[model samples]
Target: MAPTSTAEPRPSTTAYRQARDTLVALTGQHDRAVAEFRWPEVGERFSWAIDWFDQIARGNATTALWIVEEDGSELKLSFDELATRSDQVAVWLSGLGVAKGDRVLLMLGNQVELWETMLGVFKLGAVIMPTTAALGPADLRDRVERGGARVVVANAADSAKFDEVPGDYLRVCVGEADGWHAYADAYAEQPHPFETVTASTDPLLLYFTSGTTSKPKLVEHTQVSYPVGHLSTMYWIGARPGDVHLAISSPGWAKHAWSCFFAPWIAEATIFVYNYTRFDAGRLLDQIRRAGVTTFCAPPTVWRMLIQADLSGGKGDLRELLAAGEPLNPEVITQVQHAWDLTIRDGYGQTETTLQIGNIAGEPLKPGSMGRPMPGVPVALLDPLTGELADEGEIVLDLSRHPVNLMTGYLGDEERQAEAMAGGYYHTGDVAQRDSDGYITYIGRTDDVFKASDYKVSPFELESVLIEHPAVAEAAVVPAPDPTRLAVPKAYIALAPGWEPDAETAKAILAHARGHLAPYLRVRRIEFFELPKTISGKIRRVELRDREQRAFDGGQSLSQEFRDDQFPDLKA
Candidate 1:
């Protein structure tokens, strides 16, 4: 089938190219250029719609976005068509009392409706609180209430979740459903081009972080925070003009919005998404080949699974590959680089901010490092003891410099913001180790660190080592119940191919850990079990730590594979 047609306007060649190049050079090692980097200053008479989107949509008529299916079903929307469609949706939503600055919840899957609604909401200057289609009632309720959402655009299948969530917000559903606004109806309405009534500093985006240990916190971003902040993200992901880029991430998370909306658009790259019910490596590879995807990014969990598939399959039209969301293990990175002849550049950031550290296009990628700080992000490693810059400590952002990328502060919690932004810096609460070359390698969460004797241990360091072991399919390291050493580093391991949960397997892994680790960091206990992960596929160490706390609840209930006393020969 032919692609969609349009008569949309395009940005000035100079401005668009300037935006593109600025993003690419943000990660370069230039002190003067980076220090001078500031948020693109705009007036209160600001509107990304008229200033940015309309300019870009001025003369573009080709397919600006495409979503192709495995069975050859495809959907292409041109820049002009998208602009017109979004204008109509903006008009329709305005008629429904969806006013500028009003918070609206966007909860949809990879359907075309998501794009239409996102643009429509932006055009109307409505602050978007994006939710995932996978969200349950509990998650949705917190979003609507805490976010003060006035309207919600969600998939029809997820409409049932709203039943349990009490809210006075307007409910609009895509796909087939009764008593809901038909999103396609907007096409019948005339496109009423709009200019935002709000300022650039006003709230435009709000994200809820995954609360692994506590309840989720609401993170607020301004109109400029994401729109301009993603310049670094675009640079980090190595997106380019006319490049078909794919970033595999769920909707609710910040990573999705980072690449799906701002980063690719900032680069003028055609955002390509392969929508499937579940992740399939072969299917994804086929999709990548079919779409000619140049820049590909996915979480480490997806990369881990992708490597497990037959890497000997078709080498798709891939130019750049990247991994984030979790620390990419060196073994996983090495496997893909060797197989596909493509390096998986690791990146680091949080829901509260944009890309802070990443191996950008121009940099030499040191495996297992998340690269140096991006331009405009004044990053420092703060010592935990005195909160001073250190060689190895928490990754903190210096707020003294005027940077606009950070969240406006956690919603309704000035005290929390004060604490996080204390010590003249913004604490990330994630630990890292910087080498002499300034490459930052992720250690683990500050809370996840434990003590084995007097030595400090990073759970990620131990888990990374365990996952490299042939017998370990997956692993989670946390403090184990111990009598003498206070707490010992214990690993819950998942067996790889041909490995079984038996005395022989346990003995081999224990022996392997002993051989690799220092005396203070040895895996004192090993449990052969599948690891539990969060919705985003991060290992839920909080849950594991709780389990260890209860292990000593009854009589000393150590893990079945645990053997602290069995390895006497190595200790001797």
Candidate 2:
């Protein structure tokens, strides 16, 4: 069976046979799969959990989902066992007033309860609002009220987080709890598979957009966009059925669903995870080697940290490698390639979309460039001023072409949605420079771009160059206050292992930056500080920008080095 669509017919490489033939090719390794593939034109009443998983789970009583640990502990669930458990859970949840369209907030870690709740919610046709365990009381209040969540499924240990959140919503806690409803009791009920009472366009998931500058906006996705659009993601990862794919991402983020759920399941792959109280690169590599992980995906932060560890110090049968969440520094890419002999392929996407751009397997690799748009994706770079597309500008999707993977709209923000979808293009608010060779290198965010001395500066470009320096581990570039040039590029760096904060070290990094960057684009100021990151490991540049503004407002002393002021005898 192929992915089906009920909307206006559109033209693309995706058709009914695209998905079916791709599946057949992946399973059979036939050359004709590409030529015979089709993306099913699904009807308006589509439920992928019911359509795909149930059909595939029939008669497959063997292991379906596996959770392994570093201590040799593992939890394995059979296809039949999970199906029956989910059926009983759906009945029990529905009886507790969780009906179709009612939002259910889920806050858990990398445990089996997360998957069980996901299946039960999809079976009951309820909207899932995945929340990270890192969220505190205030964030929980926002999620409960503004998120329209009528029920919450969380771990018993974290149940106290909702104590300050005033609501009449139903509380279902996994594991032992004192005053909360015990979720394990649902198994006492009769097993019954659920019937879908809603269509494919129904609201199935609501994600809280990590508002870096403002309040978090609620992004809504229909039942189909994530379930079906992830086909592009599965293809990008080159994940095959039974492949043990491990993606280093936490819950509540879009990347989690991309590799952890929709994409892996669509490819019939086994989702692997290693619970860690602290991040140990060597330990993680050991788990991968011991588990025989086939497909591995992680963010740039993890990739950078991994390179600091000994590559040959560990052994793993890692076949496919992927990096996302943010633009990767070329130096990190070079180090990994030099050590592992495997290029860390770059990909581009946002919370609003799926794997729209990526460096797929069997495709050419480009340095510091995210590969061309994946299958079923149409990407165009438009000039911000002229509103006309060019080879390099802001990335936008031609919505008139009707990509099924597109989101429904931002909840309660019609004007924002209109602005986003204006002029028949959905602006991504991020800039990328595209080459004639079809490779796109990610620039800074639209707001992150600042002008210095009448010359536009991309923070990412300077930051990437800063990270190339031996003393720098992570860096973020921003414009600093300058009375003469109006503004100058400044860098906040996290030193590499065994590196220290000293005048000698800072001067060397600044000299290296001056050689790589243009005269006006050089890093005039440098500060040795830790990079602020979100729970998803993405650098919080907004925090750095705020600190820069504060320093500009008040005279403050920070470690900064400039050219022509000192240090004249360097290679540059």
Candidate 3:
């Protein structure tokens, strides 16, 4: 894309490749890799598409992408083909006046055009603002306005959602739509040499954080922050060249880019995708086997569902398994291991950064622990009160070490940036505990942790215990007001299939929790209610906390709630 430079590989590009290869070589030696790895010095001007992708793609027939549809149709593209196709797409977009630094709102599902357009936009040095198709007019309007989107590329069916969204940005659709430029027209353009316009520090992506606590913040990532920084992610995933890496993630989210796009590509692995309207564990397992997937990653939700379904058939070709999104419950991990003889290594990161910490492949994994700090990530835990490094505290990256994986900061919000980077560290807001062996385990968010009866309570710890019960499918724990103790733990639970929301079920669940958890961490109240979640499927504990506080202030109790006192047999 960058004029097909006749010259040799740039110093920066060579450094990047060497760094990636080193990680690939050090896959099984986790400690040695972390101790020895260093971030490559990518100089001022750099374009990942032109420098990294295109260079590796030339004359290479290796599969770069593989997508399997729900209806059994499949598509495969070689690295060379994708490179040339993206070049033509870049030419066509340039023809439509889409230039460098123009912000484009990308709202498409798991389609080939999405990948093509992404690469093309990267080639042109434009910023991508990926939005989920599930968003309605209100969210779309907010993203378009806040992201300062100047162009839109979406599925034809999604074009009408923009009718109520007032904007003068250019519209392009993958399918036939009136007043929208046809995305298929890109194939009509001939591949041509293009000049690179991106700098290492230029904003390449604007991601809207899934708002679990408050309004979603617009996180801006520079070219090097993701494209180059995901070296850590690639290492964590244990992906290698020629491997087919499949990750369960929806479009428009940061994890989608982390696993589905950047990390796998960095490893020179084929990115495998399976699209299904509804999740069927049996069918998903069949696809994994059929595709010969070597590396796989999914959120904890998927892992839970898979464990509930039968896994006795066997793990097909999966060598490395990973879980992220939220902390993976130990029960889910244990069940999977019992069935497949493979452990699901949990990872930790945010929309603002790549994989900062993870249970690296072939390393000794501690159940319920997210693992050590990833290579090249300056991870530390700072005590909230003392503002110093501690064994258990808020997770932060030492800015003094210069963390390249982190975002530039919240876009257009200097105040928030200043607060986040205060005390010479980039605050992660999430709390965690580090063992003497250097393994860091996630606790909960700073806002989600609360004091009950003078003891600190982590909602994740309680929820993890609750889900271990047979009747509980999903659970969210929040602090409810108490008469004597300042607060008490209250669980909002979703019942498993065939489980009734009745006194007997609640009593059994509470008894199970009492047996597993410490007395100070007892769940005092529980309500059989569906858990609220963000569009990304993360449980919204903030909303549950608010609901509990409101009910307490009004001196009213939810009729669906069952208190420990009501279950007299629990005292036995």
Q: What would the TM-scores of all predictions be?
A: 0.93, 0.92, 0.98
Q: Once model 3 is optimally superposed onto the true structure by TM-score, how far is the C-alpha of residue 387 displaced, in angstroms?
A: 0.9
Question: Across residues 289-367, which tens digit of lDDT does each residue of candidate 2 receive?
Answer: 8878888998887888898888985436787888988898889988877777777778888788888888867666778
For every candidate in turn, the CA RMSD to the true structure comes to 3.1, 4.3, 2.3
Pairs of colliding residues, candidate 3: none
- Identify the leading candidate in terms of TM-score: 3
Better lDDT candidate (1, 3): 3
Q: Candidates' lDDT values, in order?
A: 0.79, 0.78, 0.91
CA deviation > 4 Å runs, candidate 2? 1-20, 23-38, 313-315, 555-571
* lDDT minimum window of 10 residues, candidate 2: 4-13
Q: What digit string (tens of lDDT, one per residue) describes model 1 on residues 1-572?
A: 12222334333333434655765555454444366555555555455555566556645675668987656788998777777788888888888889888998998877677777878888888888888777789878878889998998987887888888887888887875766777777778888667657687888889888876667788998877777777778878887677888989888778888888778877767889887876788889888887899999998778877877888875688988988888888999899878988888888888889989888775687867888888778889999998779989999988897556788889987888898899889988899999998889988898898887878999888877777778877888999767788889988887877877987787777888877778889998888777877666677889889988887666567547658577565432
Residues 1-572 of candidate 3 have per-residue lDDT tens digits of 11222336778879998999899889889888988898998788888888888888777788899999999999999888899999998999989999999999999999898888899999999999999999999999999999999999999899999999998899999998999999999999989755568889999999999999888999999989999889999999999888899999999999999999999888888999999999999999999999999999999889888988999888989999999999999999989899889999999999999999999888898878999998889999999999989999999999999999999999878888899999999999999999989999888999999999999999999999999998988999999999899999999999989999999999999999999999999999999998899999999988998998898899997999999999777952
Backbone collisions counted per model: 8, 16, 0
- Give the Cα error of residue 341 in candidate 1, in Å: 2.1
Off by over 4 Å in 1: 1-19, 25-38, 564-572
